[model samples]
Target: MNRTMVTAVNTLGQLHKQVDLIGHNLANAETAGYKSREASFADLMAQQINNYSSAGSEVGRQSPLGIRQSPGARISQTAMLSKQGSLKTTGRPLDIAFTKENQYLKVRVQEDGTSQIRFTRNGELDIVNAGDQWVLATKDGHLVLDENDQVITFSGKVEEVKMIQPGTLEATMDNGQNIAFRLGVIALNKPQYLEQMGNTLLGLPDGADNNINQIYSDLNGARRQEISLQQGVLEASNVDIGKEMTDLMASQRSIQFQSRSITLADQMMGLVNGIR
Candidate 1:
């Protein structure tokens, strides 16, 4: 009805979105290698109108001499926090964790009968028997990509595996042969462009590589970036429970305040209509 009510209603919708985001982060608090998301708000377009034509009485006033009408605020960005989480020792040979911030392991996810490359920090790895060979994969069955961005497949039986060095996995085959697979990792050059797919995977928007810097490695070393990973350990989720709760409470308060404003505006309109 009025600008006050309209603005309040609009802002309330955005605040609810922030609350939903906070809840999502809290729900994933125990998910390994999960990163927290932070939402930011930006004010909508505002109209500045001169309420008074006379500046005679407002000569010494320091504030602006106009009424600003805004349609409230909206969630501008929900940036992913890439801070490193605490390392947890799982004692499992396949459980791995990245030791550096902004570093993510590469995996191939199948969608719509095609394989797409995605990045993730979750390191719960497993070896599965493919049709003809054994392949390294995530717990969700996404194929693990090696230094060449190719599927890490072994021709023989992998009896055991361990991390002998950073980003390198040493696998002992059943025939007493030791094969080393260097995992592929990418440093997030522009994580803001990443979209969150399901199964703890983060993917590029529309499969664009312009947001990433190529840094695959060979047996010798990486071309531009180096990665560090340790076996038998997993990275805890970076979500801070206490902070999320606090944010949720604050958002609820704001919603309540905005709702009250809308109610007051409605009452004022009713009173004006009923003027005697």
Candidate 2:
């Protein structure tokens, strides 16, 4: 294959990948708490061409062989967007939104009712009948617990789960009830580095100190703040549809341009081959 042609083909492949990513972002634009990813492009190695050494003897001699450039740019990484999405309101008591400084709720999720705890910020709360009482749950249908508690799945509908401020609850009910939830205090020194476990929960990542005091600093005070849990209001998704549409158009155009370039290169190659 000709060097330039090979490079163009590689670039075309990268563009296709980028288009796919853009399509995905647009598709999930309305999904609750969905984050958009951006594709990153990187140039392939550049070939050093036309080395001109201007010493007295070598001034006039121009090199005929040009250094070969590798195939075009490639899609490198899809960086995750950490930007805060705009919060929309739906008036429902279970629908709680986080206004706190980088705090999320912890809930239990599973294929069955027996799944482990995961973290999420989709803080729409609900109630489930955990055998005896009702308990709180996060949106996306996870049962919220006070501690690492098991969920009591019910065959019927649940009613009356309360949303206390975060850090108020010491333990949670198995059926999404907040019986133990009360005004309380947790003394954590380094709360900022909490690892995100999907579904409104945070935990100590492995090889890190679970002991809150090991990371405690007098300057780094972990003061308690109350999270307002609005009853009957849910937080809507943060995806910006306008931004996603713009990105989709840009990716589509780039793909089309690359496809055209490849087609033109192929036509030129065919002409050369036809020459007798």
Candidate 3:
């Protein structure tokens, strides 16, 4: 195939990937605690041409300009934006929002008969009875954890629950007992390393050496207290609808231009073949 066609094909492929990413951001615009991702493009390796004249070579010296032919462009990385989203108040005691960045709540999930810890920014929680124990859990039934990495559970029925402070919860049990527990607000050292597990939950990537216990320990040892929680509110998605729409239009135009370039290259090849 011609070099123009090859470059156009590669460019089109990258554009397609970018468009897909933009679409994904738009689709999750209203999702709670959803972080938007931006696709980064980089030029491919370029063919370098040496300039003998510029190098002061004695033989066959020509123009001093150095020429380079870039192969095309590609999506190099998809970085998640860490910008904080606006908080919406729901007036529900179980709903919570982080006032600081890079903080998340820890939850325990059971998958395939094994329980694993995951993190999330979505704090819309509910109370459920699990084997005669009342536990604070997410809507999907994952048990929320406390500061000690243990599931937040009550022995008896929870009559009333209130947020005494940002991270402290006071619960009144049916058996005339009141208990106070600190909510687990973990500050991630590197939030970008978290992989999206569906429903706004994030988990460590497969084969990652870091676990929930290790991360919690690190946060405690480092004395990192940059994060604070807000009760009765939830964080909205960071996606900007207008920006995503503009990017979609730009990517569509680029794709169309590359498609035209490929068609023109094919037509030029046909003309060359017809020449006597």
Best by lDDT: 1
Worst 10 residues of 3 by lDDT: 215-224
Q: Report the C-alpha lDDT of model 2 over 1-276, residue by residue, as the tens digit.
A: 766567777887887887777777777666555556778899898777765545775656575444556568987766555455566666655555554333345556673555654445565555655675545555566676543344533344444444454544323334565444532122324554455443234455555655645643211123444343344444444556787678778877876777777788889899999999
Instruction: For each candidate, give its TM-score against the true structure.
Output: 0.90, 0.64, 0.85
Better of 1 and 2 by TM-score: 1
Q: What is the C-alpha RMSD of each candidate to the true structure, in Å?
A: 2.6, 7.0, 3.7
On TM-score, who's better, 1 or 3? 1
Q: lDDT per residue, candidate 3, 1-276, as tens digits?
A: 798998999999999999988988988898888889999999999887865444454456464466788879999888878789999999988888887777888889997899988888888888898887888998778889987889998888988888875577899989889999876777776666777776577788886764645443333323435447888889999999999999999999999999999999999999999999
Ranking by TM-score: 1, 3, 2
Q: How many backbone overlaps does candidate 3 show? A: 0
Among these predictions, the greatest TM-score belongs to 1
TM-score of 1: 0.90
Sort order, lDDT high to low: 1, 3, 2
Which lDDT values do the candidates have, in the order given? 0.87, 0.56, 0.82
Q: Count the backbone clashes (under 3 Å) in each candidate.
A: 0, 29, 0
The Cα error of candidate 1 at residue 217, in Å, is 11
lDDT by residue (130-164, candidate 1, tens digit) is 98899999988999998788999999889999877
